[model samples]
Target chain A: MDKIENNKAWFLVLPVFVIVAISAIIPLMTVVNYAFQDIFSPQDRYWVGTEWFESVLADDDLHGALIRQFVFSFVILLIEIPLGIALALAMPARGWRASLALVLMALPLLIPWNVVGTIWQVFARADIGLGGWLVNALGIPYNYTSDPVAAWLTIVVMDVWHWTPLVVLLCYAGLRAIPDAYYQAAAIDGATPWKVFRHIELPKMRGVLLIAVLLRFMDSFMIYTEPFVVTGGGPGNATTFLSIHLTKIAIGQMDLGPAAAISIIYFLIILTLSFVFYNVMTRMGTGERA
Target chain B: MSLQLQGIARTVGGSIHLHPVDALLEPGLHVLLGPTGAGKTSLMRLMAGLDAPSAGRILQDGQDVTGVPVRQRSVAFVYQQFINYPSLSVFENIASPLRLKGQERGAIERRVREVASLLHIDHLLDRLPAELSGGQQQRTAIARALAKDARLLLLDEPLVNLDYKLREELRTELRALFERRGAVVIYSTTEPIEALTMGGSVLVMHEGRVLQAGPTAQVYHHPASEAVAEVFSDPPMNLVNVEVTGGTARFPQGLELPLTGHLGMLEDGAYRFGIRALHLALRPKPGLPFLPARVELADISGSETFVHVHAEGLDWVVQEEGVHEHGLGEPVTVYLDPTRLYAFGPDGRVRAAPARGRGG
Candidate 1:
């Protein structure tokens, strides 16, 4: 068979390249440029190669913030994934109740991140809000502004409240894609509910779960707004995550070179971790099928 | 074992899926023959205990099991779709039912291997369902169902999704397998030839009711009504309006046949005549009427040919034994033997059936 020869389609993609260069590539390249040079102004700069990188990599504050970021992301994933799955499983399968439940689950996700932070901020106040006042009434002496432990708990709970719905929605979509025949077959096999979840539901949800895990991991790693509004980097630097610390160095103290270096490093860290997470999940999914 | 359905019916969301079905199935193959959306699956699901009937009771060997769930019954079901555990290897998929029953490891292994070999899927044991072809995946599902050793097996058009050759091969193997098993096998299919080839008692269903149920050959030879005859045919039996008066039956195409054999028993009134596709012949006999027909379509399917023609304002299909070429709009003559004609009354009831012809 003689195939049609056409080369006109290649020129159609030029506009997309131009738009991406203007929107993303150019900004990213400027950051890369700043990371290599100590820029006081566009006209006054020194080619201080790797100096900012070395200093940013060795800073004690950077190291502390990095560890804190990792722990927060880890805890978020640990709490959110299973909780989302359980909630999705508990949701009604059909009718008006299912539609209402879906709407309720999506309510928290629709709120703006900063707005969510402010709502939690006021909602956790011991004097006026229900959450903290109820906790104080139980004699726990809860106050997010004064105690580092209370601040951490408040931030974690707020993030869970705002984001677990994404995971639930993803898993629920995956659950609904499965045909009813599998469940009937499992029932005929006399499989218990746990076994059905393990063998049928979990395996069928693997693709969506991978997306959920990676999205949650990357989003939580880069999380800044809600925690910043709620804790302002904590009672005494306890919640100063990498993004907040970078913002402090870049804007508050105005160290452009070091902050640029930290930004590049932060981008690289998220990219590398997301890559590793994706590969491991896909490999695990195929390993069973293989 | 015996499974009895007492007026079992199913209604979903104000629509009836099955209506008051009563059946007694013994430990043998029973083929449910019907077209799509004819309630074959709904009836089978009720029998499998997968769905609760809106009315009536089901008894297993005289024990009521109407309220029982599928897990409590000794029954296995295979859907038309090749549904296997996509994440499990063929061996584990087959072993699932056995393992669920808490059989010993040795017993599970032995039974899985035995059923896998029976289905000719033993070599694909280590491969997952995703890794196998559709036919092999369906065979693995069948193996899993067989490993359960259930007293009742329900296969709902299991081969309907396969290619033609694979369908033929699996049908042969499944019939052989069902022959030796003591389970009451209820297989549902829309193909009448498949039911006949399986050679079992058949339940002919139309709309939401079983129009007729009897031995396969008996139902094929003498369908209870025109509805049953249509459901039990492939290209559909050719029907033509007829008038019987003055002791002679007259066709609309100006062909006449003297009342003889089964036609003699019919009263003088309007009737419908039915002729199977294969009984319409291109070569004419001395006693049969030679009606002129115009070829509408000639479908040459491998060794057989189905010639669709228009005669007397009605279209009819003529099944030729070999590949015969006929061009569209070409005039041809078709002969219908009076002895092979079936007479139906005004209400579609089979009034008179022809005597059993050669290989009918």
Candidate 2:
């Protein structure tokens, strides 16, 4: 049989190309243009190559925020991944109860980000908030507004409350996709509960775990609205992550050139880290096949 | 060791999966012969402690283990669908049970190697299940089951998923491997040839009930009822309603045969006569009745040909020795061997079984 050549399918993707170019590429090129030069006005501009990039790289405040961002992402991942898996394991496997539990678990993820932040802000206030009042009632001196540690703890807990369900949903789907035969075989093999979790459940959930980790990492790294509403990056720059810091430089100070440079760097950092994460995880997943 | 199922029954959401069944299995290979939806897997699951019987108790060597969980039972099951730990190497897959039992590392390695080599998959031990072929994957599963060294090994049509050649190879290898083990192996298959090939004892099941259980040849030669005979035949035994009276049998469509041989002892009444498809030959033999049949469809499966024909106002499948072509509506004379006809009473019990024979 002779094969016929047809390239008409390429034409079908033309609309998507046009839409992406208009939506993403155009704005990104404008940012790249700003990164390499200083703009005074629409009429007056000076091209200062590498100056903004160098200064943005050397800034001490950006470095602190970067470190804080990394620590926050790492801490949340450590807590949420295990906690989500535990909750998923405890959930009912089937019935109306399972449906109800799923809806309840998804409620936190369904809340808007800034609303979550605002909700936590008022909910953590020592004067009127129930959580804050309970902590004070227990004789613990807690105030997120003044204390740096308390603010950091509040933001972390708030993020955990908002996002851990995403992990639970992902891991639950992964756990459900595994066939019942594997568990039966494991039972017949006399595997203990811990060993079953280690060898069967964990390995089977590798794909969704990867998705969960990447999603949590990317979302927590680029966290802006929640912290902006709750802590406003306050209390001695403790909760001021990369995004909040970048926002201060871009919008508050109105320095587009340096802001664009920081934006490009931030984008590259996430891209590079996500790529590394994807490669490591995929390699781990298929390591047995190799 | 002996595993006894005492009045075992299973009902799920008001649907009966298995009726009450009682049987004692000794340390040897026993074939569960039944078609799909025949509750072979249900019975095996109950016996392996995978599912608790809704009614009765299962005893292992005279001790009740009905409520005991599958994890606590010394049993292993190989499913029709090949199941192995996808993330684990074949070596680790086989070593898993041993490690779960907290055996020493050296012993685990040795036992894994022994079973892997026995299944002819030692060279592929380092490969994962996804990296292996279907036959190799099933071999790995069987190897893992072997490494467990359970007292009761239940194989639920393990070879049913493999190709014909691979199934043949694995079936022979498994029979030998099973013979050396002391495990009471219960191998279930829908194929009658497979049941006969793995000849030890055979339990014929239908509609979740054990119709007959006896030595493989005895059950094959003398099925307790028409249902067992039907379930035990590959192409399905051709049954013809007949009236036997005055030492003469009258079949439909004016067919008649003298009741000589073992069929001569049957009491005169309405009965069903059964002849296996293999016994219904195309060529005429001496001292046999030539029953005219119209070919409905002729199917040549592999080496043998199955010629479906309408004879005596009933559809019959004739198992020819080799490839034979017959057009639709073509008339063919089917030779009925009187010595091989089984006589079943109105209640479906075997009134007179054929004389013990060599083939079939």
> Which one wins on TM-score?
1
Candidate 1, what DockQ?
0.49
TM-score of each: 0.95, 0.93
Q: Which residue pairs come into collision in candidate 2?
A: none
The digit string of per-residue lDDT tens for model 1 on A1-290 reads 99888898778998999999999999999999999998878899899999999998999999999999999999999999999999999999999999999999999999999999999998999999889899999999999988989999999999999999999999999899889999999999999999899888998888899999999999999999998998899888999999999999999999999999999999999999999988888777444431
- Candidate 1 TM-score over all chains jointly: 0.95
Judged by DockQ cut-offs, the docking class of candidate 1 is acceptable
Model 2 docking tier (incorrect/acceptable/medium/high):
acceptable
lDDT on C-alpha atoms for all candidate structures: 0.92, 0.91
Tell me how many residue pairs clash in candidate 2: 0
Give the interface-residue alpha carbon RMSD of model 2: 2.3
- Top candidate by DockQ: 1
What lDDT score is found at residue B270 in candidate 1? 95
